[model samples]
Target: MTDHAREQATILETHGLTKDFKGFTAIKDINLSVQTGSIHALIGPNGAGKTTFFNLLTKFLKPTSGQIIYDGRDITHARPAGIAQRGLIRSFQISAVFPHLSARENVRIALQRKLKVSYHFWRPLRILDQLNEQAQATLEQVGLGKFGDVKAVELPYGQKRALEIATTIALEPRLMLLDEPTQGMSAEDVSTVTDLIKRVIEGRTIVMVEHNLNVVATLADQITVLNRGEILAEGNYDEVSNNPEVMEAYMGTTDAA
Candidate 1:
């Protein structure tokens, strides 16, 4: 494909997407497209409907009106498991991992989904041994190789988040929806995970809801800013960051004339 064709290839799209809770509207008439292999950031102040939008796309919450098209198919009514099966996966702000399981075991569990035995824990342990090598490789990819034998709860906060990324990678997702991937972390840990995110962006598209402007500025190919459940601005970081409305939305005021 030519450069133009590649840039035009959209991996996910939402048309007039909205969600309502009783009489309240969480997200209203949102239309967005994410290009293939691009990092798209959804940013806004608190309660900007970022998480609601993610839920709608992941089928965790059904949209009140509009369609969710992924890779050219409408999946608005698809189940969460079905959505995940199609290679659209999400990671939460909180580190998600098996607290008691070893790091290798956690990744192996995710890898088992590909083998079509995600719930076959009753099967022979030897059957899962086949995934051990791949699990180790994934751990290494996320910089957790040396901690494979360590239990997830025993790992440091940063390593725990790394393990979560490792498991997410083991599933081989085509599109990843990362919700606050750097939510609560030290400056050093944030930088480390940011680099990890950059390293993993090859060959896949990422839609992230990030509050860290630095991370968004560094990684996002495009940005959509939201306020009060509607889009306030859409463009590259330089464009959105400089918009007077975006500045007011974020800082409560723009520069004086």
Candidate 2:
């Protein structure tokens, strides 16, 4: 890609961003810019306001000050639904699937929502074969094809996490915000999820909050370390990883991991 593409490719931008709850600041005067088609990782210790930042970007929470720009448009005050309609979507830190529904059914529901199809109780679900096919394809993309017929809650924890990814990908978002995508996963499961995340960023922008330094090192094209709700450093893996401030903030030591 050209330099212009690299710079102007910023799909998400925040300037002087701040958020406060009852006189307590959650995020302060933060500035962030994410390049298009890049995997940008946000890392910090517990209670560092990472989730609050995700909420702000996805329009779940309004900023007390500053602006949020997506694809050249000012979306600082847009509604969550409007942001999703504009091709920005977020997956929750917690599992957000219907436990009683089949994995395929969960993805199908997401597809229907993306297509804006009205729900009809009178019609049989079999009538939507095309939708089913799309959902299956999404499942395959996330390596959950064989589990499509299983109830979401019955699947293993790792599989359920994969299902969540499938559901998010089905929306075909231009930008995706993932919160703790690999939380509570095994080492093998973490690798699986990491590969899936890389694949999903083929033509989209991704911003995620992860505590796993290894995962961040593996997937993040750029890393932004947050401390006490403010940006401490942002750069490529090597840049941020080698920064003394980041080391001190995260590990409480300047020694390399």
Candidate 3:
């Protein structure tokens, strides 16, 4: 695709994305392009640079060499906070929730952060009420409408994950990057988070690094398989899963997750 068309349909892209630490290359020459509104999965064996690449994409780490483009603009050198302002947001495996705060309060805080407001809730009562309403709506969107009053620390494990997602939605991101959003949970929690992820993905682009192939198979519009920091295959689930090279890579590593 031409640059114009590519940029038009693509929401996030990386060209020659390479990162090296102490002469040890983590990712080498990775070229990935995620469509404007699609769920893209990044999967590979352990130590395949998935985390490193994720850190680079989210600006948690600067690339040794490469260009990261988001929404037709170069963001390779942008800081994490700057990238977030441009609508590319990322969440780590651990939920970033204030355990002492209620679910509603957590969402409210995230909204305030999104709006760049000072954390002094004493600013204005009227604006606080408005933020409350918006936070409730965001919570409702993630199936946490009934848990608004519950303390985040008191919530069930799955519910805490849901709360995290709700806070993320409050940011109104155009593109979201989730790192193992469903990492540790019961089967029921997995199902719950899976359904929630499906619901939240409407009209937005999502790129996730996940271990649950089941979730990836169910939700990902595109999948990229990485091995030893290099992309081994990329396509829909079936296409990449059927690749002999991908199977071989997985076979060598017991972590098929």
Question: Worst 10-residue stretch by lDDT in candidate 1?
Answer: 1-10
lDDT per residue as tens, model 3, 110-223: 788745565665676456566888898898998899999999999999999999988888888999999998999899999999999999988889999999889899999999
Residue runs of model 2 more than 4 Å from their true location after superposition: 1-8, 119-124, 255-257
Clashes of each: 0, 0, 0
Q: Ten-residue segment with the worst summed lDDT in candidate 3?
A: 113-122
The better candidate by TM-score, 1 or 3, is 1
Model 3: lDDT of residue 221:
94
Off by over 4 Å in 1: 1-8
- In candidate 1, what are the lDDT values of residues 134-229, reduced to their tens digit? 999999999998999999999989888889989998888999999998888899999999999999988989999999999999999999999999
Q: What shift in Å separates residue 184 of candidate 2 from its native position after superposition?
A: 0.9
Ranking by lDDT: 1, 3, 2
Q: Which has the better lDDT: candidate 1, or candidate 2?
A: 1
lDDT of each: 0.92, 0.88, 0.90
Using lDDT as the measure, which candidate wins?
Answer: 1
The candidate that achieves the highest TM-score relative to the unseen native structure: 1
For all predicted structures, in order, the TM-scores are 0.96, 0.93, 0.94
lDDT (tens digit, per residue) of candidate 2 on 1-257: 88677557788889999999999999999989888888999998888889999989988899999999998889999998898988898988788999999999999988887444646766766666679888988999989888889999999888888899888888889998999999988999898888889888888889989988899999998888888999999998899888899888878999847
